[model samples]
Target: MPAPRLVPDLVPDLVLDLALTVRHDGKGGIADDLDGVDGLARWVAARGDELAEAGAPLGDFVADEDALTAVRALRQAVRTLFARAVRPAPPSPADAQRLLPGAEALDRLAAAAARVPVAPRLTWPESAAPEITYVPTASGPPADLLLAALARAATLFLASDDRTRLRACHAPRCVRYFLKEHPRQEWCKPSCGNRARVARHHDRHRVESAL
Candidate 1:
């Protein structure tokens, strides 16, 4: 079984899922799912349907070292922006001093997004409301197209009201950002919440024993 996640995998935003690729391993260490080209390919494959639905198809896509590098860089920017969005609240430990400055992150995201020029297409079904979708208007390498799509997703998420719901998980060893799904929601998941409570209990016990 997969380890519990602070954020659900079904989040509508790809960038959030991308940012969560870096998470706390169950054994008390940071784990990166996209630590290599193969890992990146796997991650892409897992999200193929969602990416296609979002207007970036990756049919038979294979990731190279360059693609890994590009996606890693974009992930850094997205994570940094996520940290910023949860301002006043502490950011994930993963971002401590490694995050890009806000301005630099913004520039990087914009550059990646501009790599592929896209045009909006309208679609409406008989009983469904009309939706505007952006599709690439220029040819580019699969990596470039994927990067642009991720950057655009990040851009849209940052501009949406959902951004206000972003929060970094504060449970020990957790380095995830989750959307605040409820007014009483604290940690990213129940396990994190339990860990936090247990930690607090231990601290109080220690303090009482010391006194």
Candidate 2:
């Protein structure tokens, strides 16, 4: 059988998309899509237009070790926030504090969040009439812009009612997180759902044989 492609679906929100970067395989192994500087670059490139629409473009990405490190740290922080928020209990003050460790980080995120423009404006496509579009106004190194975009996404996600629907895939070898668009949706994708069902079937057979 062919391997399944890990295509990025157009998630309802950016924060949920970011959380999908690091996934746990149902079999106890973990995979980080943004593993290093190159990985980070690729991830950004893949989402270039999306980020641009959100007012953060990757045209100035540094692709250095330091930049990669910063991005990874921020990714982990965002993941931490999501993990805690989705728990049955409400997130505590300490939980929120962990996301914004120091004054500097907090300021950076705040600044980035502030950079998002108020509204999308009209733009004319070649040979077409003007259409409303979000032109990126945020400026800085790519990493900074990326972080700011992430910060903004995190803020919006945590503040919205839809945050309650954020869920991590329950399949044993799957590590993806997804927004539960429908009440019955369980896994990140159909493959994960099939894998989970197969595992359950095997377990049931094993128990029956033992009995």
Candidate 3:
């Protein structure tokens, strides 16, 4: 089989993407894309445009040890809340035991979102429709700003109707949370569905042999 594709851009929610940084490694183990400072920098760069749109522009952002630690903390909180949102469903097994309490996660997200001041600004091009975008008002540490924007995104997603569509991918070894784009959507992707079917087939085969 081809490698399990862990695409960060698979979802529109920045918070969901951040949580998905932890995923299946295709070897019966979990992988963390932000395992180190370098990995954190790469992750930030990959989401530069989206971050900028969300009012936390970190152009050419460089990740230091502190940045990596802070971002990872925020990610932990986000994942905790994500697990809560998909209640009655199993969360990704990667940090299943390490999730923060629901109340604590809410506090963390609120605090992180307040790290930088932001205000909604409206703009319109000559031939385009008017739109509003949140823009940071003051300067702060790159990590702090990024965390604020990401937390805000999480806040909005959790409070919006879209939260109902979020589901944890329970396919074997798939440590991912995905937005249920359609009614029939089960796993995070088609590949995960294939893996799940194969695993079920093997289980049935074993049961038949036992009989």
Candidate 4:
């Protein structure tokens, strides 16, 4: 039997969930269609992907085929920004604008996401000391604020002993995040495991037939 996926009590889990919501097209790659991938992961990954590629960090992205190069560049930037949970502070306003022109929406969000706390610091770092650590009295805080808050909260709450394990699903087409199971669970689940097994089987059969 497959083990259950690890889902820590992230006050507001964003990056992991958001990145997982991609769907596979008939071809072997991600598709933007939200039909199949709509769920918790979808919601978060959508926000992430929005900021990452569509230039809608504050949830104001508009979909248009206006420019291919610009769109691809935006996505690459997003990926680079969120690759590390503990990234450097958001760029200065001037730098943000320089990195993504006319993308004030995402620039603002990137600044916010970059603020998420990632360390188990006892006292606020001199840098973070100036920042107001806003804890939400209400749930479902704005995505940007939620991400920042979660980062700070986690930093405060976690211990050096309290481990934060990151796992990527083994599925080739899926870049989803999952918590590490209790000494088990290599793939995300039986479904993904079976699908991968079948894919390997078909390839092996084809190769044998050719032989």
Who wins the lDDT comparison? 1
**Model with the higher TM-score, candidate 1 or 2:** 1
RMSD of each: 5.8, 8.3, 6.5, 12.6
TM-scores of the candidates are 0.92, 0.70, 0.88, 0.42
Whole-model lDDT, model 3:
0.82
Q: Pick the candidate with the highest TM-score.
A: 1
Q: Residue 16 in model 1: shift from native, Å?
A: 1.2
What's model 1's overall lDDT?
A: 0.85
Over the stretch 1-211, how does candidate 3's per-residue lDDT look in tens digits? Answer: 2221112232246877898899888898989999999999889888888887777879746799988888888889989988888988878788778899888998988999899988877776799766555678899988888888888888777776667899999888899998999999999999999999999999999999999
User: Which of candidates 3 and 4 is the stronger one according to lDDT?
Assistant: 3
lDDT per residue as tens, model 1, 102-131? 999999999999998988777778997665
RMSD value for candidate 1 = 5.8
| Residue 55's lDDT in candidate 3 | 74
Consecutive 10-residue window with the lowest summed lDDT within model 3? 2-11
TM-score of 3: 0.88
Query: Which has the better TM-score: candidate 2, or candidate 4?
Result: 2
| Candidate 1: pairs in clash | none
How should the candidates be ordered by TM-score, best one leading? 1, 3, 2, 4
**lDDT of each model, Cα atoms only?**
0.85, 0.64, 0.82, 0.39
